[model samples]
Target: MSMFSGTIQTLEQSLNYASAKNRAISSNLANLDTPNYKAKDVTFKNYLAKELSQPLQAKRTNSKHLSFQGEAQPAGYKTIRQHATSYQHNGNNVDVDKEMANLAKNQIYYQALVDRINGKFGSLQTVLKGGR
Candidate 1:
């Protein structure tokens, strides 16, 4: 059964990206007033572009022939780096409103991706149960 193709892989990657973004936003929000604290975010678009551009090698698990797709994913979130931002008082360039908006949007995207994943699994289950 051919499964987990391009968009599906992209969606899965997006899931992790959004999750990491949520954490980054949370961290910035928590340090709202801390001095010299810079806002941080994962370069999700950049990472996604890189992932999409590369030819996907079949991800493997313990055994060679036992090809479990996406079983061994790359450690991506560790690549997140801080970038320069607009100056502000309290040494914090973390814009709360902007971060909040981004958080909401990322949440919606994450939820949509999760729904799609669930739907795919549900369809698989139905097929396994004799397509009833």
Candidate 2:
């Protein structure tokens, strides 16, 4: 496959994940004032791990070659996750501090993912255009 295609595909996946995470964080922030509002988050790592471990091919008879792990394209992301039960005296399950921290972390991760995609494009450009 072309380098551009690969980069585009990866970027699309990252963008999807970041957007979903943003939605989750927004929901948590919005429910801060709501009573017994448990924070919700996707099982990102678990889903990703299972996706990674899945076999790509239908069936391979030979055991000599390296077994394929997963598919070329991602199975996409999911926003469906579990809720965190709140134990606060105020009845508000939303923890502002924790949610804020999570938001910051997600922001950083989103930026990093973007940077990596940018780097991929940059490398392709460098390869295409001879050095000055």
Please report, as a residue range, the 10-residue window in candidate 2 with the lowest summed lDDT. 78-87
Query: Against the hidden reference, what TM-scores do the models get?
Result: 0.69, 0.70
Consecutive 10-residue window with the lowest summed lDDT within model 1: 66-75
Cα lDDT of model 2 by residue, 27-87, tens digit: 9889778766677774467767777676674345677766665564365666663444655
Candidate 1: where are CA atoms >4 Å away? Answer: 6-9, 49-83
- How accurate locally is residue 39 in candidate 1, as Cα lDDT from 0 to 100? 85
lDDT of 1 at 85: 70
Compared with the true structure, what per-residue lDDT tens digits does model 1 show for residues 1-132? Answer: 448555567668779888888898899899888888888887755555666665555645457555433333343554353556755766678888988998999899889999998888898899899989
Top-TM-score candidate index: 2
